[model samples]
Target chain A: MKKGKAHVLKIFDNVNTDYIISGRYKFKIANMKDLAKYIFEDIEPGFYKKISKGDYIVAGENFGCGSSREQAPWAIKEAGISAVIAKSFARIFFRNAFNIGLCVVSCDTSSIKNGDVIKLDLKDELVINISRGERIKTMPIPQLMRKFLDDGGVIGHFKKYGDFKI
Target chain B: MGKTIAEKILSSHAGTELKAGDIAICKVDFCFGQDGTSSLIIDSFKKSGRKKVFSPSKFCMVIDHSAPSPNVGVSEIHKKMRDFARSEKVGLYDIGEGVCHVVIPERGHVRPGSLILGADSHTCTYGALNALSTGVGSTDLAMTLISGKNWFRVPESVKITVNGILRKGVYSKDVALRIIGDLGANGCTYNSVEFYGPVIRRLSVEARLTISNMAVEMGAKFGVMEADAKVAAYLNENAKINKGIEGVTADKDAKYVKIKGYDISSLEPLVAKPHAVDNVAPAMDLSSIRIDEAFIGTCTNGRLEDLKIVSEILKNRKIHKRVRCIIAPASKRIFSEAVKRGYIKTFIDAGCVVVSPGCGPCVGTHEGILANGEVAISSANRNFKGRMGNPDSFIYLASPATVCASALEGKISDPRNHIRV
Candidate 1:
C-alpha cells in the first residue's frame, strides 16, 4: 500500500510522443538524462523547469498518441515525473511506460484541475483530489504489470530472474 | 463461437487454444530493429547478460532513421549498430537500403500467418500480407532478441469493411485518413482491426501496405487484411516462397467488438490538418492553406506506384516557385525502378529534388526540415506537432497525388483537378 500527495501539472488531449520529446533530440542526445531537459519543449517550452521531483502529470484523453519511441517515456521518467494520470493512454505508450517502470494511471481526470494536489493510493486504485475533495477510481493494473512495477521495470525483473516469469 | 484471424494466428503461434483477452507467450517468426530504437535495444540486450542473439538469422538491424549520419552524435550511434551487427553476425540493412517497413517486406522476410515484431510502430505494415505483426518497446524487443519469444495479450477484433470503387485521385492514403478520422486517435485502443470487403480485395499489395501502416494512428495493436491471390503472387515473384500461400482468415461467425462500413465510391481526396492525424477535411476545403514545402516519401507513399502518380501530375508543368518539392522512393529497388521508368527525370524536369531511398524527412532527422511559420503538404504518416523538426511549423497529410497537385498550386488543392479520371 502506497499513498502520497501528487502535485498536478495539467495538459490537453492527444499529447503525442513527438510533443513529449521532439524527434530531433531523439538521436541527438543518446543519454536519457540529457534528453530529459527537452521534455515538452515543443508544446510547452521550459516544461522541465516547471516541475519538481515526484510531481504527477495529469492530462486528458489519448496521451502519448504518436510514435513508439521509448525515448518519450524515458525522458518523462528522467525528468522526475512520478506518474502520468490521464483519461486514457495510447497503446504503445502504455506498454512502454510499464516496461520502463513509469506509473501511468487512467481515470476521470476532468474534475482535477491544474496545480491541484491529489492523493494517489496505488493499492486501492483510488485518486483523491484533496483540493476538490473528490474521489476517482482508476482502472486496475494487471497482475503482471503490478509485478513488473514491483520489480522496478522489465530490466530489473530480467536481472532478478534469468527469464520472464510469464 | 468462431475465432477471429488474430485469435487463430496467436493460438497457432502459442501452440495452444487462446482467445481474445488471454495472455500467452508466443514464438515470433521474425523480429527487427531500426537505428532510432536499436541503441536502447542493444543496451537492454547487453544488460540482460545475453551473449548471443537467440536466432541471429531471424533477427535484423536497419539503419534508416537518421541514415548516413546527419550529425556527429548520430554517426556514433550508426557506428555502434554496425559494430554490434558485425559482432553478432546478424543481418543488417545499411544506409540507403530504405525504411525498415518497406525493405523487410520487399526482401521477402514477411509471410502470411506468421507472427512478426519490430521496434518501430509502423511494423504493422507487414500485416498487409496477412501476418500478425505489431510494434514493441526497446526492452520488449531486446527480450525477444535474447529469448526468440515474447508475451502478448490477444486483442479483441474490430472489422472495418469498405465497399465500392474509389473515385479518381482518391488513393489508399485518402482511404486511410478517412478511416482514421472516423475512428479518432484512440478509438480502437488495444484492439486488432481487420479490413474487409470488395474494395480491399481490389487494392494492390502496395496500396494495402499504405492502409496497414497508419493503423497505429488509431491506436490499434494490429491492422491486418485477408491474404489473397495477389499476396501469394507477390511473394512468389519476390521471395519465391510457395508453401503456406493460403493464409488464415476469420471464421464465418467470428466475433468482433465493432463493425464499421464505408462506401468509398463517393469519397474525395482528404487531408489531415496540422498537429493531429484525425483532424481531417476535404482537400479542396483547405485550398487556402499555403505551403512552403511539398514532400512525397516515407513508408506510407514512397513506392513506385506513388512516384508514378506524382510524375504523371508534374509531367509538363513546373512546381510553384515558392514551394520546395522533394520526392524519395521507399527503397533502392524502387529508386532504380523509378529511374528506369523515367519518373525521376520527370520529377527533375518539374523542379523537384529527388533524394536517396530512405526515410528522409518523415522522421525529421534530415533531407527537409521546415522552418519557423512554414507549412508543408506531405504524403507521410503522422502530422504531430514538431514532427518535421520545427514546432512552429505546420504539416498537412495527404496522398501523393494531392501533394503533387498542391506543389503546383502552392497551396492545398484537390488532386481531381490535376489528374484525368
Candidate 2:
C-alpha cells in the first residue's frame, strides 16, 4: 500500500499492447531498460521522457489489450509507474503485470483527473483523491496474484519458494 | 453439476473436479513460445536460476514471426532463439515453417482434452480441437518452462450455439467476425467460450481453426468446439491421438454462465472496420471505400481452402493496378500444397506477392507493410490502428473471398456477386 501522484496518460478503451510498445521494438531489443525508451513512443512521442517515478496511470477499460508482448508491462514498470488503475484489463495483460510485480488496480477511473496526486492503499484496496477530496474503492487483487507481487515477480517468487507455490 | 467442456478438461488436467474461479496449479501437456516472446522467456528462464527444463519434449520455440529476418536486428533475435533451443534440447520450428498456431495443430501436436499454453495470445487457436489452450505472458511461460505447471483460475463458460445452414459466399470468417461484433471485444473477457451446433460441427477442421483463432479477439480464454468426425479424421490422418475422442464433448447437462445463439442461414459477409475488431458492418455497406492493398493470407484464412478460393477469384483477372495483393500461406505444408495445386502460380500470375509461410505484415514485422494513408482489406484477425505497420494506414478485416474481390476492384467489395457456386 502506498500513496502517489497520478500522472494519467488519459488513453481510451482497449489500449492495446501495440500502442504501448510497437511490434518494431519487440524482438529488436533485449534489455527492458533500452526497450522502455520506446514505450508508448508511437501513441505519445517521448512518453517515457515525461512520466516520473512512482506516478500512477489512470485509464479506461480493457487497458493492455492485444498481443502477449511481455514488454508492454515491462516497459510500464521500467517507466517507473508505481500503479495502473483501469476499469478492466485484458486477462493476459493482467497476468503479465502481476508476474512482473507491477501494481494494476481495477476501478472506475472516470473521476480521476490527470496529476490528481491520488493515494493508494493496495492492502486496503482503496484509492484516495487527496486534491479532489474523493475516496474510491478498488477491486481486491486475487489472493494468488498478491502472493506473486509480494515476492517481487514470478522469478523472485520461485527463488523464495524453490517452486511457484501459492 | 455437469461440467462444461472447459470445466471437464480442466478438471481432468487438475486431477480434481473444479468449478469456475477456483485457483489451482495444473500440469501442462505442452507449451510453446514464438520468436516475438521467446526472447523474453529465455531471459526470464535464465534469471529464474534454473538449468534443466521441466520437460524438453513438451516445450518448443517457434520462429514464424518476422521470419527470414526482416532486418539484421530481427535476424540476431532469431539466432538467439535458435541457440537457446539447442542448449535446452527443446523443439525448434524455424522460419518458413509456418505460424505457430497453424503448424502446431497441423503437425498433430495438439490433442482433444489437453492443456496447451503459448506465449502468444492466439494460443487459443488449439481450442478448435476441444483442447483447453490459452495465452500467457513470457514471464509466466518461462515459469511454465521451468516447472511444467502453472496456476489458473478456472473461467466460467459461455455457450455459443450456431445453427442453420450457411449461404454460399458466406464463410466461417463471417461467422467469427459476427460473433465478435455481437459480443464486443471484451464481452467474453476471462471466460471460456464453448461453441456447439450442427453448423459448427459441419464446418471443416480448417474452418474450426479459423473460428477458434479469433477467440482472443472476443476476450475469451478459449473458443472451443467438441471434437467431431471431421476433427477425429484430421487427427488420425495427421497427428497421433493416443486417447479416444469420445470423452471430449461437453455433457448434455453442462452448466453455462450464459448462452447465445446465432443462425447462419441468412448470414452475409461481414467486415470489421478500422481501429477495432468489434466495429463490424455488412461488407456491402462499405463497397464504396477503396483499398490500397488486399492481404489474402493470415493464420485466420491462409489454409488450403482459402488459397483455392483466392486463386479461383483471381485466375483470369488481374488485380486493379492500384491494389497490392499480398498472399502468404499460414504454414509450409499449406504453402507446398497450394503450390502443388497450382494456386500459388495463379496468385503470382494475377500480380499477387506470395511470401513464405509466416506472420509477416500482420504484426508489422516484415513483408507487405502498409504506408501511411493507405487502406488495406486483410484476412487477419486484428485490424487495430497500425497493426499492419503505419498507424496512419487503415485495415479492414474480411474473408479471403472478400479480400480477393476487393483486390480486383480496388475497393471494399462484397464477394456474393463474384464467387460462382
Candidate 3:
C-alpha cells in the first residue's frame, strides 16, 4: 500500500480530464499500463511519464468541470497518483473520486502552488505540506467510500462486502 | 399574468407548499445517468450504504460519452456499472444501447408533465416532450438514490410565445440558438422556459426536441411544451413509451415572471459567438469566420428528422475541400433509418463523416473535435472553453442549417439563403 503524497509541479485553475487523458485513446488502450503512456500527452506534455503514484494534484474551482467521465479520476489513480486537492470539485467528480477510493480533498486552492510537496492522510482528511508545515482540507469520507478505500477500489470493496443473494 | 407551462409543472410537483425563497425537496419521478458518470453513480449506490433504489426502474443509464470506453480505465468503470446494475436488479439501463438522452426518450421514459432529473446538465434535453427535467450533481443524485428526492429553488417561469411560421431553411435548433443568444447564457438560470404559440405548436415532435434539448445552454431547468394531442400521438406510436403518465398543467391564474413574445417568421439562421452562448447574431451578419468542421448531432438535434433536414441541404452542394463535415445520429435506430432512406449516402456523397451514435465531437471527446485555432459551429449543446477539442478551438452554437451551410462554404455562412430550391 502506498501512502498518499506528491510534489506538485504545476498548478491549474480547472484541469478537465479530456486534456488529462482524453476520449480519443479510450478504446485504443484498455488497461493502466497502456493508458498511462498518453496521460496528459497533449495538455501538460511529459506529465503522464513524469508523475508517480502517491503524487497530488491541486486545482482551483470546478476541477473536472465537463462531462461526467469516471475515467478522469480513474486514470489519475491508475497512473500512481494518490490524491487531488482543489478549491471545490464539480458535484459529480467529487463522488466519482470516492467511488473508487481515490483520495480527493477540497481546500483553499489559492493557499498552495506548484512545487509544494504534500502528505495526504486519508483517514483524517489531513493534507500536510511536508516542506511548508501547512495543512488544509475538508473531506469527510462517507462510511461507504471508506470501505472502498480500505479494500482498494470497487472490485476489492465488493469482493469483501458483497451480499451474495444472487 | 398568464403563466408558462414550465412554471405550472414546477409548482405542481413542488412536494410541499412553495414560497418565494424556498428550495423545495421535490421527489424525483425520473433520473438519468450516462456511462461517463454511471459507473460512479452505481458505485456510490453501493457506497451510500443504501440497500435498494428508491426511484422506479425507469431510472436509466445511457452509455454515451465514451461508450466504447476510450481507454482501459474507462473499461473497468463500465464493467463495474454492469456488475452493479445486474446485482442490484436495476432495470432501464442501456448497455452500450445508445446515447443517454436519445436512448431515454427512445425507450419512452420521458413524458410531458413529469419532473425528471439527470446527472448530466443536458438532462433538460428531455423537455422537448414537455417534461420538466434538470441536471444535478452526483452527491445530490446519491441522496435521490437513498430517498428518491431532489432539492431545487422553485424557478421563475419565462414564457416565450412564438407567433411565426418557420422559414423553409430555418430549424428549431436555429430558433433555440437565437433565443439563447438573445437571453444570454445565464438569463434563465434557475428558471423554467415554456415554448408556446403557433410556431412551437407547428414544430414536429423531433423539431420540438431540437428546441427543448438546448435548454441547458440558457441555464434553464427545461424548455417544455404542453402535452397536447401531438405529444399523445407521438407517445402512442413510439412503441411502448412511458404509459399511465400524469401531466402538469398551469393554474388558470398562475402567476408569471416574464412574458416574452417573438415573431421569428422572418428570422434568419443564428450563431452564438465564442465562449458564450448569448453572444449571438444572425448567421448572415458574420460571413468571414471560417470553420474547420460543421457538426450536426447530439441529443439536441440528432434525430432522423434533423438528419433529413441536413441531408436535403448537403445533397445539393459539395462540402468545402478545406473544411470537414460530420453528422452523428442520436441512436442506432436513427442510423439504420437514415441508411434505409439513403440519407447517409447523401452525406457521404457530400464528403461528411457519419459517426455512430454516442456523444462524439459535440463533447470534444470523440468524433469531430476542433484543433487549436480551429472554429466549429454545431447543433450540439454547449460552447464552453475547450468544449470541442483544444482550449484554443472556438465553438459557436448554431442551428443544423448553419452547421450544414457553413460546412459547404468552409465558413459560418447563412443557411437561410441555402434553402433547397
Q: Please compute DockQ, using alpha carbons, for every candidate against the native two-chain complex.
A: 0.76, 0.79, 0.10
Residue-wise C-alpha lDDT for candidate 3, range B168-198, written one tens digit per residue: 7777877887787777655565567878899
In angstroms and one decimal each, the interface RMSD of every candidate reads 1.1, 1.0, 7.5
| Backbone clashes in model 2, listed as residue pairs | none
Model 3: per-residue Cα lDDT over A29-89, one tens digit each? 5554667666665556778766766678777655664445566677877888778777666
- Residues A35-111 of candidate 1: C-alpha lDDT, one tens digit per residue: 99999898778888887777788888889888889999999999888888898988888888988899898999888
- lDDT order, best first, reads 1, 2, 3
The chain A TM-scores for the candidates, taken one by one, are 0.92, 0.94, 0.82
lDDT of 1 by residue, B1-421 (tens): 9999999999999999999999898999999999999999999899888788999989999999887788999989889999999999999999999989999988888999999999998898988999999999898899899988888899999999999998789999999999999999888888999999998999999999999999999999999999999999888876788898789999999999999999999999999999899999999999889999999999999998899899899997999999999998999889999999999999999999998888988889889999999999999998988898888899999999999999999999999999954
B212-246: candidate 2 lDDT, tens digit per residue: 99999988999988887788888887676646665
Question: Which regions of candidate 2 are displaced past 4 Å?
Answer: B240-243
Alpha carbon deviation, residue A47, candidate 1 (Å): 1.1
